[model samples]
Target: MRDVAVISFSQLLVDKAEANDAELVMPVVREALGRAGLQKQDIGFTCSGSSDFLTGMPFSFVGALDAVGPWPPIEESHVEMDGAWALYEAWVRLQHGDIDTALVYAFGRSTLGPIEDILALQLDPYYEAPMWPDATSLAALQARALLDSGRLSDSDKKKATAEPPKIVDGAAAVVLASGDRARKLCSRPAFISGIDHRIESHLLGVRDLSHSVSTEIAAKHAGCFEKSPTFAELHAPYSAQELILCDALKLDKQVTINPSGGAQNNNAVMVAGLIRIGEAATRVSNREADCALAHASSGPCLQQNLICMLEARA
Candidate 1:
């Protein structure tokens, strides 16, 4: 595999927005490209993450392609998962050694529809989807399990149960370059030391909601436990889930958690996980952290997880 680093990242989040998906995505794409001192054509490959279900239209991501200006015809692909998975795909593409640089972006307008109902569609159609359980209710089931599992203290439980999630509109863009290409793009780059993702059984009842086995496996494969991370950007949509991730990752109080206030501050659906990665990269690029961990998740109640470890070298 080739050495790859996060050269530039940009993000925007709003409680409510009137702009279309393409309109919202364009600015961040421009910002990331501009920060990397590159133009659209300079990007060797491009990938994006978004959901047509949220947009209530098919090929909604195709329309967002205009945001990247595919007029000259650029190599691109889209994932129905979070933008973090898009970054994962770009990382793999870069490893092929055919591309020196790639652009990854994700956008979502959760305000467009009933987020709870839309997210419920992600559950098993035969068992869970038919029941039409909302996102919070499902999460609450997990939270209740964790509380009763004897894994958390009274204060931790109180902190976990504080408030509900607030869905927002958001988008994020990241520029990745390999080896020498990375050095030319930025003075300091957050080199991707390792990255991996894992998933668990889809059936909520059969899985252990109190613990994130997938996160532990992904983090181990990503080499996150090789050294203590100074910071962690976890894509926990709820406070209880954040606690679950902390335990799974084995993070201590000395480690900074969610300096960006996490998803609870701005839950942007598909975009939040990518924002976590961008936030961690920014810390490394700025020399605030020598090593950091960024995590993203898909599926209900933390059924799927991706962990990426980053390091800054002088």
Candidate 2:
């Protein structure tokens, strides 16, 4: 397999943003490209992640292309899911051997609408969506199950200190390069040693919410169990979910989890996952961590999960 590494990353998070999506993405994209010592036209491919549900407008991501300088026309793709998926797509594109570099970004303004209501739409239309259970409520169900299962004691739960996720507007971008180009772009590129994603049964009733089986499967496929990472950036919006992820990945106390505060600090829907990845990449790029684990998730009750193992080049 061709080696792919994250060369540069940039992000912005705020309680709310007065600027539109394109405006929110422009500066971060510029910063990421600039840090990689490249220009807009120099990019080989571009992919973004966002949702139209927040804006109540279809094809909302199309407008964000203004930030990537689409004037000269560039190869691009978009995912309705989180930006981490877009990064995955970019990594796959790099494996084609024709492209040496790619740009990946994601932006979301959860404050634009009732985020809980928007998230509830991800549930099954026939069963869950009709009931309109908010994201927090669903997460609470998982927490309750975990508590009852004896995995999370009152003290353990209290230690984690579950906090209501902050609904914020944010944008994050990362630059990816292949092999030698990665070395040229950044002194210590965060190479993607392994990455994979998995989804459990959509019917939340059949699956065990107390633990993330999907995360474990994804972690196993991503080689997360091969070696321990010094840092772990998990996209768990709830403290209980974080606990579940730590258990699923078998991370020990030595692993520093969410040094950037994770999604609970700033949950911007589609953007937060990419921010976790960017944070992990930045830690590796700066030599703060020799190996790192970055995780992203979507759907209700941690139904979908992605794990990316990053390591600093020798």
Candidate 3:
């Protein structure tokens, strides 16, 4: 596989975005490209992540494409999932050796609708959706299970409870390039050493709510535990979820967690996961950490997890 690195990253998070999805996305896209010293045409491929459910309209992502200026007709794709998955697709595309550079982005406006009720629709339509359990309640079930498992200390539970949840509006973008192309775009690139993603059983009843088996599997596959990370950017929307991820990833006390204040402090639906990756990449590029582990999750209570390990060139 060819060496790929994240050369540039940019994000915008706020209580609410006054602009539309396209308007909110354009600035971050421009900033990411500008930082990489590239333009729209310079990007060989573009991938985005967003959800039509949040927009309460079909093909909402299509409107956001205008922000990227498909005019010259750039190759592009969109994922209904988070932007971290879009980044994953871009990484795979770059591996084909045809494209040296790609642009990945995600955006979300939680204020568009009743976000909790919308997320409830993601559950099993027959078994769970009929019950209409909101996202927070679903997550609380997992948290209660974890607390009952005796995996976390009382202090951990208390700490988690103390942090209030903050869901914001945001957009994030990242520029990726391979080998020589990556080296040319930035003085320091956060080279992707390993990356993997895994998912748990969709039925919450069948899975172990206390532990993230999927996260552990992905982290193992991504070589996250081969060496302790200086820090981790975990896409944990709740404090309790952070504890669960830390345990699953086997991070030590020495590792700093959530230097960006995490999703609990500034959760932005689909955008938060991509921001985790961008935050970790920035740390690597800035030489704040020789190596970092970034994580993203989708579904209720960490049902799907993606882990990425990044290292700065020696």
lDDT of each: 0.92, 0.91, 0.91
Quote the positional error of residue 5 for candidate 1 in Å. Answer: 0.4
* C-alpha lDDT of residue 134 in model 1: 89
For 1-314, candidate 3 gives per-residue lDDT tens digits of: 79999999999998988999999999999999999999999999999999999888999999999999898798999999999999999999999998899999999998788888889999999989999998888888887888888767768877544243687889999999999999989999999988999998889999988899999999999888786689899999877889999999988899999999989889899999999999999999999999999999999989999998988985
Name the lDDT of candidate 2: 0.91
Lowest lDDT block of 10, candidate 3? 157-166
- Candidate 2 regions exceeding 4 Å error are 159-162
| lDDT per residue (tens digit) for residues 262-306 in model 2 | 899899889998988999989998989989999999998899999
Q: What are the TM-scores, per candidate, against the unseen true structure?
A: 0.98, 0.98, 0.98
Error of 3 at 256 (Å): 0.3
Q: Candidate 1's residue-wise lDDT over 1-314, tens digit each?
A: 68999999999898887889899999999999999999999999999999998788999898899999996999999999999999999999999998899999999999999998888999889877998998888889988888989978878989666256888999999999999999988999999999999999999989989999999999999998887778999998889999999999999999999988888888898999999999999999999999989999998999999999988876
Backbone clash tally (model 2): 0
User: What's the C-alpha lDDT at position 51 in model 1?
Assistant: 91
Q: What lDDT is reached at residue 161 by model 3?
A: 41
